[model samples]
Target: YFFRDPERRPPDLPGAVVAPADGKIIDLSLVEAGPVHDSAARKVSIFMSPFNVHVNRIPVEGVVKALRYSPGKFAAAFQSKASLDNERQYVDFAGPYGRVGCVQIAGWLARRIVCHLRVGQAVHPGERYGMIRFGSRLDLYLPPECDIRVKLNDRVRAGETIVGVLHETK
Candidate 1:
């Protein structure tokens, strides 16, 4: 099947950022935010196994400001350095309170990354927007003001688990 139905709906929490893909939370760290985000941000990387769902969902309600695809080497998604060298797609969303970024990284076992949304498109929290065939990795980038809720080695379900929460800026 190309997509699997979600067993549960996304939670209705204020400023909640949901997981984009169902997988194990492989890494969590503070990384230098790319051009799509500010100076520094919290990075949550998820490693999707073949048994996990491949479909991806929107992390928050927002407009897609930018979508970029970077082609690179196919490396193991669990490796920290793989984020920089792996083939990936970067999606930036402008939420009501803040901006967030999601990167779909191609792992050594994943051959394709499919994204359905485009620039300037409106999306909602937990909305299914894309998927990666087979196994892959998804990285959620949160602004400095947001708080991450998931930890390394945590198992997260796409669209159902709250990965982080955005805090309003003064």
Candidate 2:
């Protein structure tokens, strides 16, 4: 069954929600850990294979605040440097809960990262937002202090797995 199916069974737990892309978790870095503009984020990278699903979904319910499209060389997304050197689309969404960021990276031979939502658009958790036409990677950057539940290289189903618990700051 494909993700984003209207008839799909709903999840039974509470958290930020599952990942939005189909791939293996390649890296999890707790970058700058701390408030909004002053706060840092944890970067989780999912490497998509050509044989995996190419569509993406929203990991949490929120409203799109801004969209930044970066034009760069199309590199193999699984490579260590792809996250830095490849073309990418960065989207920032702010919910009543917190801020969440999504990054779509273009892989070798895959030149497009199509984001179909606009600024101010509201999105539901697990809702289809856009896709990387062929194969690429999706990075979910979360606020620091989030308690993650998934492991590196773990196989995850978009919309069906819980990757983290959106922690409440003390």
Candidate 3:
């Protein structure tokens, strides 16, 4: 029962950006420059302990635009740099608001990362789209206008937690 796929309630907050995995929020910061589609962006990192649910969900409603898997070293996922140094897959989506994406980073004990999403497919918030074995992490990258709702060290449930809100001011 480690890979539980609990039925998650759809977020009631307008323009909600839900958590992509069940775990503790490890990092919440604005990326000034990085390889996540653009330069300035808001990022939310969730660390999935071996005991937490492993199923991953889409964070927002959009059309999948890109999917890139990078094979890298096995590192402790709690480190901030693990995002770039660890084996990971980047899944990005294009919607009315802007580009939103998530990364599935493999943990030290993680050997396989499974992503059920394909490029050009339509995705929705809280929808199960991928998974990773053992301890792992999920990082949500949002447009700068997206207001993050979750905080560092906060525990979040995939598909049910409102990690951020995408503003439609553009």
Candidate 4:
């Protein structure tokens, strides 16, 4: 069940950003100049249980600028510190709205993260980019111009739910 790939249809509204993973929203916060991103961003975190689909998708259409993987400790997917302390992979993209960062974090049961993205590869929203074995977490660092759609504790489906709508910055 965890390996099944479901068909998803992304919203066509301009600037609409789709959820990258199927999970429950665990966090929504503002952050600045940390790790993969150097500008102000709003992080939308989702915690995936072992029963949920492990596949991950692109949140927006963009060109991958970099991919960074770090070996670290296993932690609970819902913990705030897990984003930093857990083994993870970060994908940085140069999007139409600017920079976007997606971090795939390993939880207690997840040890491997499979990523299909390469530096400079152009990706579209809803496209499968990777997967994490068992349970894990995904964090999307979005620009401040986003109008977020989901609230904390809300459940979202990868490549389908519109997590937010981004607006162009002046």
Candidate of highest TM-score: 4
Pitting candidate 2 against candidate 3, the one with the higher TM-score is 3
Compared with the true structure, what per-residue lDDT tens digits does model 4 show for residues 7-79?
8888897777899999999999998764556777899999999988889999988799999999999988889
Give the whole-model CA lDDT for all candidates, comma-separated.
0.88, 0.77, 0.86, 0.89
Better of 2 and 4 by lDDT: 4
Question: How does candidate 3 score on lDDT?
Answer: 0.86
The per-prediction CA RMSD against the true structure, in angstroms, equals: 1.5, 3.1, 1.3, 1.2
TM-score of 3: 0.95
Q: All candidates' TM-scores? A: 0.94, 0.87, 0.95, 0.95
Provide the lowest-lDDT 10-residue window in model 3.
Answer: 30-39
Model 3 clash pairs are none
Best by lDDT: 4
For candidate 4, the per-residue lDDT at 68 reads 94
Regions more than 4 Å wrong, model 1: 1-3
Q: What TM-score should be assigned to candidate 2?
A: 0.87
Candidate 1 per-residue lDDT, tens place, 1-170, comes to 54565655999998999999999998888877753676898888999998888999999988999999999999888888778999999999997768888999998899799999989999988888989999789988888778789888999999999999887655
- Error (Å) of candidate 1 at residue 115 is 0.1
